[model samples]
Target: MINQSVNEGKTAAIISHFWIIGLIIAFIMNMSKKNYFSSFYIRQMIGLNALQFLNGWIVYKFLGGTAGWIVGVLLFVLWIISLFGAIKSEEKLVPVVGEQFQNWFKNF
Candidate 1:
């Protein structure tokens, strides 16, 4: 059963890593299936998207080029880590902010 859920959700989990559009698709897929594996990844993607907006847009707006670039790279690294986890069927969170994401998006 666990293996099946992981397999079923793996695609959605991977899809969730492709930024906004992928997140949307993964979310819709998971909505019907309601599997824990997909939900875990979807929630993480949503949180990453939020942070990307907050740090990318807002920070870039205020702090100018360099800070925004650095943060963007960091977020990209985090995204890579998250994507790898999804790919491996692992629930590893993306460092510092991962826990916060899980808590905030618990309902998803």
Candidate 2:
């Protein structure tokens, strides 16, 4: 049973990184089961998605140029790292803001 939950959690974690919709689905899925691993990744992905949205908005509204592209690439890299960590079933942090994200979203 524990192994099954872990497997489900891992699957949820991986799915959560797919995109905004995936994150929402995974969040709903985790709410019922409350798997720690899934919740952790869900929070991380939520933070990433929020950052991406904010960056896009700022770049479109103000910093319209190569700066936006650069930030987009950096965010993509961070997303990839988080996705790989989920694939490996590891609780690796997402980089600079990862720990803070975990702390902030602990209730999830």
Candidate 3:
């Protein structure tokens, strides 16, 4: 039973990294099961999604040049790394603001 719960949590964790929709689904899944693993990934994904949104606005609207593209690439790389971590069922904090994200979204 413990192993089954862990597997479920890992599955939810991995799914949470897909995108905003996946994040919501994972959030709901975790709510039902209350899995710490899924919660960790959910918080990270929330932070990542918020960052991506802000980055998009700043880059496209304010920057609108090579700088915007560069930021987009960097965000993509971060997303990939976070997704990989989730897939591996590891609580690897993302670079830079990962720890901050965990603290900020602790209630989630």
Give the per-residue Cα lDDT of candidate 2 at 105: 83
TM-score, per-candidate, Cα-based: 0.96, 0.91, 0.89
lDDT of 1 by residue, 1-108 (tens): 999989999999999999899999999998876999999999899999998999967889999889999999999999999999998999989899999999999999
Q: Residue by residue across 32-82, what tens digits does model 2's lDDT show? A: 779988998998998899889988899856988688888889999999999
Alpha-carbon RMSD of each model: 0.8, 1.7, 1.8
Once model 1 is optimally superposed onto the true structure by TM-score, how far is the C-alpha of residue 16 displaced, in angstroms? 0.6
Tens-digit lDDT string for candidate 3 (1-108)? 755655779988888888988998899888866998889889998998898888888877887768878887888888899888877767789899899999999999
After superposition, candidate 3 runs with Cα above 4 Å error:
1-5
**Among all windows of ten consecutive residues in candidate 1, which has the lowest summed lDDT?**
24-33
Of models 1 and 3, which has the larger TM-score? Answer: 1
lDDT for model 3 = 0.85
Q: Which candidate would rank higher by lDDT, 1 or 3?
A: 1
Candidate No. with top TM-score = 1
